[model samples]
Target chain A: MTVYEFAKGLILEAGGQVRSRMDESIQVETKSNPNDLVTNIDREVENYIYNSILDTYPDHQVIGEEGHGHELTQLEGFSWVIDPIDGTLNFVHQADNFAISIGIYKDNESYAGFVYDVISDTLYHAKKGEGAYINRQRIKTVEQTTLKTSIIGINPNWLTRSKSEAIFKQIVADARSARAYGSAALEIVNVATGKLAAYMTPRLSPWDYAGAAIILEEVNGVVTDLLGNPLSLIKPSSVIAANPQIHEEILTHYLSHHNEDISAFHQYLNSK
Target chain B: MTVYEFAKGLILEAGGQVRSRMDESIQVETKSNPNDLVTNIDREVENYIYNSILDTYPDHQVIGEEGHGHELTQLEGFSWVIDPIDGTLNFVHQADNFAISIGIYKDNESYAGFVYDVISDTLYHAKKGEGAYINRQRIKTVEQTTLKTSIIGINPNWLTRSKSEAIFKQIVADARSARAYGSAALEIVNVATGKLAAYMTPRLSPWDYAGAAIILEEVNGVVTDLLGNPLSLIKPSSVIAANPQIHEEILTHYLSHHNEDISAFHQYLNSK
Candidate 1:
């Protein structure tokens, strides 16, 4: 089977496994901080995907959220970036809105990507040089719209705690409306599908956005750090994924004026 | 038929009509402000529901989001409150996450309430003395969870613009996480279903919380203005809907410390 086919099949199977496991009591734990949650299902799903990839393509490397493939950092050859459960807090609390995301890379270039909304049975996937699809139905590119006519997704915490808090607060006021779904993958998918004009965050890891970056790019959406720089596939960075128009507008009008604040934030992120 | 049965049937049918009309080109307009959006579908659905209610119970009064029943002031007899499309911006842009909300009242008391999620076809409804349901499945009362272990939903705008910004900022920081779904009705439903520990806003119309208040109360959830006062059935007010434990804790610990800020905000809302 082609690499895309194998990845798609594995993600679907993993989603099914997650759905079945939801009925049983979930064991929860925290990492990094008290609010950052992880569940037994997340580790189990990651392990299953990691083993399955090694068994099928022994030469391919894997990097996952649960640290199964953390040692293999460089995307030198064929590598898979996986977030077994993209929204662990949502998964544990709401039992909905979480997703399993996977991105396949060849020599640091995106090859294929998939984000499976397990509860909704919706799969958003794309391959290099090809268009994106939601459950096998092709999705249209985001229509051109301005900030005043758009709906953006942003976490409320950023508006309160980020170094560029004032800048983000202005952006929230300027936009037509704002929503926070608490899932980066789903918010990025919403941008690709034209549901949200933009989705921004102060920081996101590779596994949090790798799959979504591929799908968004396929549909003419732009994914970049807050400084308008391309995101690193090997490290966490501040992210802003939006349609082409809003992306440029925000970078120019909003983010450009506050370089000092944004730089400070990025420097803080790097220090961490 | 009983008021609950008739209201549920009409809401389901209205949801069907709204879904069918989504395929057509929508006419958009703003009410009160540029960000406040309304669409042709909203008017059509409200009109349908208003006419259907009057045709069935001519003596019953109706109050709708659109101006269909705005003149009706006193809820001395049987009354119906309707928000044909609760999340107009979502309906216009994302085409999902919006809902149809209706609450039936008799002499200022809740008789029945229904909030239909059109895209998913899930109906959350409740009668005064009856327990709440989701598409006929009985939902449990909100589970006991602390602020540090709970997920609450609050519009980010409140954190930026309200008089209680600093207080709300603290509340958000103290919570495990915060989410904003952009629809008051759906957010309140999330509180009732225990998907969200609490949902609060600076101000919301009676139509916004009328339906959700009944559903939440049926599930042993508390619905009140931010100051812990009961919501009026004929006017707008600040809202905080939560499980019993969180409700008491938040009011006692957080909001009570800053009554001046909250009251000033409420006064501004009343002035508007």
Candidate 2:
């Protein structure tokens, strides 16, 4: 099978395996701090995908959350960054909401991105230079939607972090409403589908965004840093993903009202 | 058919109707404040359910979100409290994470409850004594879970609300981790299935808690006012719903830590 077909078949197969074991007992462990959880299932699922892909393409590079894959200096040819379970806490505790994420980059360009919301059996996929799709239907972000006409997704954690607080509060106070769905990738997908006008998460990792970043861009949506600069696929930044028209509106309002402390926090993170 | 059977049928039909319209062009509106949203779809779904139930059981009382039915007083006799789309904001924005909530109470005792997550096609239901089920198999709260093994769900708004700051901070310090899902009924259902250790929301309306409150109780879970008192079915409260063991830990460690202003807020609401 070709690489794309092989990845698709393997992802669905791995997802099916997970569904069968949904009701079985699990061993949950903490990561980083107490609030972050990792389950044995996450590791096993990642391993299954990793081994399957490696068997198909022996020379390809992989960066996986389970730590079982190779790490390289730069993205050269074919590289896959996999988040076997994107919402691990949602998986270990609720047995749902977690998803399997896989993205393929060819020669430092996002080639294909796939996010399978396992429990719901919904697959959101995109190929570079092609339109985004859910089950093969074309998707596009909504246009000309004002803040009052839009529903924005935000991270609740951003509400308290000093750097994100003032701007975040102003956006919430200005928008028709704001919601936090707990999954950065999924929320961006919502924006691409026009289900949400925009999505902003102040803290995200590359794996958390790799898939949705490509999908949103394919649908004519924009993703940027908080200061209205372009987002790089190499690292995570304070993300603002929205339709192009409202992109500047969000950033302009955010910067106009940002306080000194908020700017200081951003400076601190940039230094790191 | 028995009352239980009839209610189940109604719930399934209404759920299917809501699902079929998921992708239709929608007209959205804001409610009460810019931070809250109401949709034409929300009103349509509630009206559809309200009319269907009233047409079938003309004598039954109905309390619905759109104010389509009578003004709610006490939960007397055969009353059906419905939140046609419990997470209107999620539905309007994410097109997911929302559900059809229905609660059947006979003279103040919960008789049957259904929270159908239309997108996932998962129906979390209980008949007071028949035990809780997710797609017909019996389910229980996470077994042997403690605060350290738990992830609590709280609204981000609580962090900024003056009265909730201390308790909110204490919860952040206490739980292994925390999240804000933006749906009260769904969050309560998460507690029923052990997806979350606890779900704390400072303010809720009866329509928001009616359905999941019943299911949570059937799974050996507890939903009480922040002081650990039983919830009043007719009025919303500062709620903490959890597995019995973890419930007390949250009450003592987090809820109790809030000073007089928060307690007064709770008491002031209860008196109303």
Q: CA lDDT of each candidate? A: 0.90, 0.77
Candidate 1 residue lDDT tens string, B1-272: 88888898999999999888778999999999998988888888889999999998999999998986677667878988899999888999988999999988998888988999999999999998879999979989788778889999998777677575766888887888899998899999999998899998888998898898899999899999989999987778989999999999888999888888878877888787
The reply for model 2, stretches above 4 Å from the true place, is A21-31, A68-71, A142-144, A147-149, A160-167, A229-236, A255-272, B22-31, B35-59, B68-72, B141-144, B263-272
Worst 10 residues of 1 chain B by lDDT: B158-167
lDDT of 1: 0.90
Those runs of model 1 whose alpha carbons end farther than 4 Å from true positions after fitting are: A162-164, B162-164
| Lowest summed lDDT window (length 10), candidate 1 chain A | A158-167
Alpha carbon lDDT of residue A263, candidate 1?
Answer: 80
Q: Estimate each model's TM-score.
A: 0.98, 0.87
Error of 1 at A39 (Å): 1.0
lDDT (Cα, tens digit) per residue for candidate 1, span A1-272: 99999999999999999999888999999999999989899999999999999999999989999996666657878889999999999999999999999988999998998999999999999998899999989988878789999999998887677575766988887888889998899999999999999999988989999999999999999999989999988778889999999999999999888878878878888788
TM-score of chain A of each: 0.98, 0.90
Which candidate achieves the best TM-score against the true structure? 1
